[model samples]
Target: MTTRILIAGGGYVGLYTALRLQRRLRRGEAEVTVVNPENYMVYRPLLPEVASGTLEPRHAVVPLRAVLRGSRFIAGRLTGIDTERKVASVAPTAGPWLELDYDELVIGLGATSKLAPVPGLAETGIGFNSLAEAAHLRDHVLRQLEIASATTDTELRKRALTFVFVGGGYTGVEAIAELQDMAIDVLAGYPELDAGEMRWVLVEAMDRILTTVSRELADRAMTELTGRGIDIRLGTQLESVEEGELRLSDGSKFFADTLVWVAGTRPQTVVGELGLPVDGRGRLVVDQAMRVEGHPGIWAAGDCAGVPDPETGRVSPPTAQHAVRQAEQLGDNLVATLRGEWPRPFRYRSRGEFVTLGKNKAVGEAFGREFDGALAWTLRRGYYATQIPTWNRTIRVLGDWLVGMPFGHDVVNFGSREEPRGAFEEAAGRSRVG
Candidate 1:
């Protein structure tokens, strides 16, 4: 019997690790299979662009079968894992659960937006974690402009025009900056709504935006965003959400139409099912080799696994850079385990961080230097294009950047109308007839 290797969550780690294994292992050596909710691997770096209509939603996601080379693609979401039995619990797109037996397992289950008990937040807010969220935001932002243009009531117009983004990390900053920029451009198409009438606000509990970058870059980014009339609320936290009005900890309330939740993400619950040593954040504890400590034939990487940073003696932060590198090492280790060789430890250092503002504007800290504006923007694109799995994809993405330079962003609005699927009680009061 062939050695079966099961990989869960085909985001960065799942997709890349499977691809690496496919390339290294011989046909009869081991059977490699990937399990994910979707067949495509989203190029998460360009998600901000997708939300802003700078690139098509489909462009950011690569078909797993098309790019994964030679590997079995099981279109399913991993529900749980039995490490001792080497059987993974999986639920297909629309079916009951089944157990997928594996000789070795790679847990790359990824993370979800951390949702707290802020009233009405679960139903009212939109998260920017996946491609669907990006697409939904694009549609919703444009639709808000349409609503603003048609309304005569001052309060209604104000509500429709006000766009609030919570959190100012890379995801939050890039999303609001691009969407705000796109909304301004879209206003040109709607003569009735002056771009100036629209309010773009960024609320950060932290003192600065893009804390991943240098202090200088963060300061400059704040100045630039505020200069563009974006209301920067520092040391502010969201208190509650009721009747489409958001109340902040500062005792200020705004009846806003859009609220973007990019506060943070927590590791998937699959880690908890493993019953291994997990941190408070639900991340699996792994040693330098990316192996679950004291657990044989099982490895975890990406956002789901907590790989410690040797220098700081703390877990490494979840990032695409770390995930991709870890995936490569995980693949090598898994294949080595298949043979007689012992796998090497997984150690990685972050290259840098970058966040794109609007157009050719960006701020980044790379190679121990801070960069801003066009240079940083160019650097960001170049880095992602190279890191992306295939050259075919890189060429296509580079083409997108080139196309955007001359024609500008194409605003495509498609409203969210999909039926919410979950437990009946969860959707009972939440579901609305559109």
Candidate 2:
């Protein structure tokens, strides 16, 4: 009898864990199955570039079928798990629920934006967590440019041109910076619009941003952003966004059509629904070795699991670096457990942290050495290009970078992509009415 290993969530940890299992498990030793909501894993760091049109959206994702060779890939979500029966209930896109049996389970469902009860944020504001949003943002920004350039109404133009971003962490900062760069670059084509007239505001409730890295590096990022004329409100909060009017806690108000919320993320709600023992933060309670406490055959890691950092003696932060390291270690430990060998605890200190401040600009500390400008940017891109997985994807990303060097941004707005079936539906309606 072969052991069936069920891996949930095909994000960084899920995919990488399955990849490792497929490589390590001997033929007939075990069967590996991965469940995810999507068929591709979005390389989140490159989302800013995607929004800026620096890299095509398609290239920023790795198709699971193309990469996770020999593993069973189920395009769906893990709705629940029955530990007693050793089965997981998955809901597919358009079908009946599936109960997959397994000898062991791995959970890595990742997280989603943790939105607060700000007045109109839930309905009006958008998040920067997915590839779809990045693509939509690209089109949306260009559409705003078109609207501002064509309309003679000052208020409408102001509203269209003004872009507000909440949160000043890596996601928020990189997104605003890249979009701002794209907007400025494309302004040349919109002859009537002056870049200075466009308002770009960053709102953060905290006194500082990018708290993951050193204070010095964060200061450097602030300098780069503030130097570009972006309005950076240090101790600010979004009070409301009712009817396109944005009110902040600092007793200021503004009207902007675009509001991006990249504040932070919480584990996917399914983690709690799974009936597993999770921490107060709703992350699965796992041992230092990445195994779920009191469950010998079950394991979890990544953002969904509260795995402790061996060095800091604190739960590891939910980051790509930690996820990758944890998954790799989990894979080895899973194999070891299968063979009745001692499992090793996951341990790895972060090498460094980097923040991309748009094209040819970045701030980072690598190996205790701080860097800035083009060198930092190049290093950041180089590092990500290598880590994106598969030679084909790496080459395509590098090619995009090399080709983009000599050119300004591609300003063609494909907002029409958002409504692909509009024409077809109209045609069908006309035919019926005829």
Candidate 3:
């Protein structure tokens, strides 16, 4: 008998789960297939460096073809899953809806950028979640310095040099820190532009930044950021961003050309389309075994699924750490189910939280102890290197770091911003043509 398995989303959970599934399942008993919009599993932990031009954009992405040796990999975005029919509709690049049938399904579609509207945000603001965004940010930041140096107009120059970061989680903090470091180095090339003139603001609605870490560390982070002249705004909100106006909750107004929205993410909408049992937050509800409740032969994990934490009695924090662990155990449970054995519950405590700040600076808490500055930075890199699933990636990343230590950033603009714009841009061009 052939048991066909299909896994969705090629992120941390999807890739790792499939890797484990292929290893654990009997040779002829089951055939595993994984589907994802991206053909590669992006090592998202290093995206900050990519945005800052510290790491090549491609360095963080591991191609699925090379990684998933045994399992069949499909490049497609999931449209819907009919649990009753046990069929999945996939929409690949420019093709009819591809149908895939699965005896068992793993929902790991991962989270998406929660782009709640703030007026003019889409056009003017950049996001920090994707490879494209990382590259664009690097180019934009460098270009800003060049523009500022050549331009005599003070307002235009200020607008160009100013950078706004909207969220203050690990992504926002690390991004601001790394980019700030990079900008300082890049500014050395332009004699006219003082690095001090460039403004970096970290905007967060919460009372403090890096709330995931301990309060002591969060306060230290706040002091460090402020000391570096990065304005830390708390209990505030962005009302809108139109033209030059950036309205805020504290009756404050600011103007800048750059706005980086790290506001956070939500699960993919395909989960709702699947008509599976979902939580209020649009995440799939899974048991301790990582199996979807009331659904036969179906399982879900990662940020897209609500896996409860036994210690807290709440859903597990949707971090990369938890996602990988869930996938690992989920694989083991599925293998046990295939063998007609009782599956074990997914139970693990979060080891700690860590955030990187530029080259040799970081802040973290591990095993109830706090580590900051150089030591934390080393631990951060060490932990991720170990966490990365493949030896090939581990070696490549380590080599890159070794070279980057003495030699500074390898910054280059590959020019990805030339995608054709709409009628408005065409109209402007037409007016010029006349």
Candidate 4:
């Protein structure tokens, strides 16, 4: 009987794991099947550029079907796992949930935004986690600019121009920086609005931002962002975001139509519902070999897995750097297990960290070498351009970067794309009655 291997989640872990397996597994060794909601795996690191319209959304994602040619791709989510019977229940977008039996299982179901009890946040706030959100944010920002420019109401303009972002991590910082830069570049077109009228705020509960990198690098990032009139409130918390008004624990309150929450992420609820062993942070508990504890023939990796760092003797941080390394190692370990050989432990020391502060500006520390300004910015782009999977994506991303060099961000708002049928429906007098 052919061994059936099931992989869940098509983020970094799922894609890399399946890619490695396809390369090593022979024609008859095992049948690999992957289940994910989307047909493409987004290179999430470049999402900031997508939000700023610097990179096309299509180019930033690797097509799963094109890359994982050898594996059976299921455009669905793993709704449940019947581990006792080695069966996985997959809920596709249209069809009823079906169960597939597998000899081995690899759960890499990644994470989702972990929101707190801040009122109105659920309704008003958006996250920076997916391509949809990134694209929507780009259009949303441009729409806000339009509202601020054409409106004469001072209060409405102030609210439209105010942009508040919670979290000072790399994701939040890069997102706000890129979008802010886009806003600044487009401001020249608005004759009535001064750049000073726009407020960009970064709120962090910690004493510093970008704590994953060196303190010096974090301080440098703070300096650069503050210089651009970004309000970086250190050691502050978001008290509430009620009725388009944001209140901070520091006793500050403001009205802003845009609120981006990039605080952090927790493992998908399905990870916990699978009856697998998970850590305190709701991540799958994996041994050094990337195998889930007490679960034979099962493995987990990426942001959803609590992979141990051999160097630090602690769980590795949930970063793309770690996810890529862990997925590679996990794939190797699975192959070794299939071949009746000893599996290897995942061991990787990060080369360094990089944070982009808009175009041509960044702060990074890699290989014990610190870089700032254009040098760091160039290095950041070069590194990601090279590392992004598939030459097709790499070339396209570089092309976008090169083409955007001499020009400012495109201010055209494609918000209408969200409701493409709206115009036709209205013209036909078929608008839905409330």
Candidate 5:
């Protein structure tokens, strides 16, 4: 009998695992089915560029159907799992719940922003995790510029021009830097708005930013950002956000129209509901081979799984590189188990880490060497271009970069795109009255 493999989530792990299985498995070897909320996988590292209009929103995502040709794809969410019966419950986009039986299951249902109990934050602050959020941020920032330029009220203008980011990690730093760069570049078009009036503040509870990188690199990044007029508030916490007012632990009070929250992330809520062995951080417990402990046919990886790192003897840090490597090992292990062969343990050393500051600006360490500025930026782009899966996407990404260097950032605001049906609704109302 052919084995049934079900992979949940279409992020890095899900996509890569399915790709590996499709390539390795022979005809009638095993049936693979993938379930995910979105039909496309967002290239997360390029999200900063997407927010800055350096790359188009569509170009930053890989269409799942286009890439996962061999496996069955279901556009839905994995709601629950029955480990005893080996059945998974899926809720499709426009249908009833589905019960899928699988001989082996892979859980890669990524993470979501971890929100603190800061007052009014849930209602007021926005996250920078998804593609939609990145695109929305671009439009929102442009709208703020328009508001600042047209308004004569001093306080309102100050609020509109002020942008606050809470977090000092990779996402927080990269996002603020890219968006700030874009705003400065487009300031010439807003003749009424002065660049000096814009305030970009990055608040971090920790003493340093980018703890994953070295202190020298972090300090270098800090210097680069501060040189660009961004306020780097170290060891500061966001106390509260009330009615557009921001209170910090450092006894500072401010009112800013835009507040971006990128503090940290936790696994998807459904992961907890799966009744599996998870660590204290709520990540599924998996051995070095990416297999869930006590559950023979169940496997997990990526941000949602506490996959042990052989080199460090600790759970692997949730990063794109680690996730990709883990997925490959998981796929290979699954194949080995089916063939009655012993699976090898997943082992990988850190090649490097790159943090993009802005266009042609980055800091990275590769091959035991530290690099910064344009060289690091180019290396980062080249690495991601090759890792983005399909050649079609690779060409489009490179083309965007080539076009962007000469033409500069696109400043057009398409905030209306969010409400594409508004015009139709208004027309329908008018027709009814007529």
Candidate 6:
């Protein structure tokens, strides 16, 4: 009988695991199935570029069907899992829930934004986690500039020009830097809005930013950002947000039309509902082999799994590098189990880390060697371009970069794309009335 392997979530773990299985499995040895809500997987690292108009939104995502030709693709969300019956429930876009049976199940459901209980935050703040959010941010930022330029009220202009980002990690730092760079680049186009008028603030509860990198590199990034007139408030917290007015922990209040919440992320809510062993952080408790504890044939990896780091003996940080390695290991172990061979533990050493700080500017460490400025930027770009999967997407991403270098930032706001049918709807309504 052929082994049925169902992989849930089409993020880094799901895609890589399926790819590994496709390559290793003998013909008819196992049937691989991948189910995800979206048909495409967003290459999250390029989201900052997407937000800054450096890369097209479509290029940052990989079509699941196009790449996973060898595996069965199901466009749906995993509703639940029945471990005893070896079945999983899925809810498609518009249909009854479908149940799937599998010999082995892989949980790679990934994570969602962890929003704080700040007043009005849920209503006002925007997250930079998804492709839609990133693209919307680009259009929103440009719209804000237009609003600032056209507004006669000084208060409205201040609110429109003021942008606040909460979080000092890779997401917050990179996002603010890229958007700020874009705003500055396009400032010349708006004669009414001066560069000095726009205010960019980065709020972090910690004393320093980029906690993942060395203090030296973090300091260097801080210097670079501060030099660009971005206000970095360390040991500060966002107390509340009400009616576009933000009150900080340090007793300061300001109005900002744009508030990006990149504070942190937690495992998806559905992961908790699966009735699996999860850590205090709500991540699935999985062994180094990426197998769920006490659940044979049930595996988990990536942001949804609390995978023990071999080196640190702690739960591995949810990074793309670690997720890819874990997925590969999970795939091999599954294959080994099927072949009646011993499996190996997942192990990975830190090769390097890169943090992009706008166009032609970055900070990173590779092989114990620290780098900053343009060299770090180039290294970061090259690494992501190669890692995004598929030759087609790789070419498109690089082409965007190459084409953008000469043309500079594109200021055209396609916000109307979101409401593409609005005009048609109005026309139809007018005709009906007539």
Which candidate achieves the best lDDT against the true structure? Answer: 6
- What candidate 1 gets wrong by more than 4 Å, as runs, is 416-434
Clashing pairs in 6: none
Model 1 over residues 187-222: C-alpha lDDT tens digits?
A: 768888887788888889987777666778788888
What are the Cα lDDT values of the candidates?
A: 0.85, 0.92, 0.85, 0.92, 0.93, 0.94
Off by over 4 Å in 3: 416-434
Give the poorly placed runs of model 5, Cα more than 4 Å off: 429-434
Report clashes for each candidate as comma-separated counts.
0, 0, 0, 0, 0, 0
lDDT for each residue of candidate 2 in 1-434, tens digit (9 for 90 to 100): 99899999898999899888888988988999999989999999999999999998999999999898889999999999889999899998778999999998999999999998999999999899999999999999999999999999999999999999999998999999999989998898999999989999999989998877789999999999999989999899999999999999999998999999998888999899988899998899999999998887899999889999878899998778889889989999889988999989999998888888888989898998999999999999999999988999999999999999889999898888889999999999999999
Task: Give lDDT tens digits, candidate 6, residues 1-434.
Answer: 99999999999999999999999999999999999999999999999999999999999999999999999999999999998999999998778889999999999999999999999999999999999999999999999999999999999999999999999998999999999999999988999999999999999999999987788889999999999999999999999999989999999999999999999899999999999998999999988898899999999999999998888998887788999899999999999999999878999987899999999999999988999989999999999999999999999999999999877788899999999999999999999999
Q: Estimate each model's TM-score.
A: 0.93, 0.98, 0.94, 0.98, 0.98, 0.98
- Per-residue lDDT over 1-434 for candidate 3, one digit per residue giving the tens place of the 0 to 100 score: 78888988899888888888878877887888988888898888889988877666677888898888888988888898777889999998667889999988988988877876788888778888888888888888887777888999988998988899999888899999999988887665678989789999888999988867678888877777787789888988788999977887788887888899997889887787788889999999888888899997999999899998877788988788889999999888888888889988889987888888888877788988988888998898988877776887888777778788887665455454545455678899999999
Model 4: what TM-score? 0.98
Off by over 4 Å in 2: 430-434
Q: lDDT: which is higher, 2 or 3?
A: 2
Q: What overall lDDT, based on C-alpha atoms, would model 5 receive against the true structure?
A: 0.93
Lowest-sum lDDT 10-residue window in model 4? 425-434
Superposition TM-score, candidate 1 onto the true structure:
0.93
Tell how far residue 302 is off in model 4, in angstroms.
0.9
Best of the two (1, 6) by TM-score: 6
Clashing pairs in 2: none
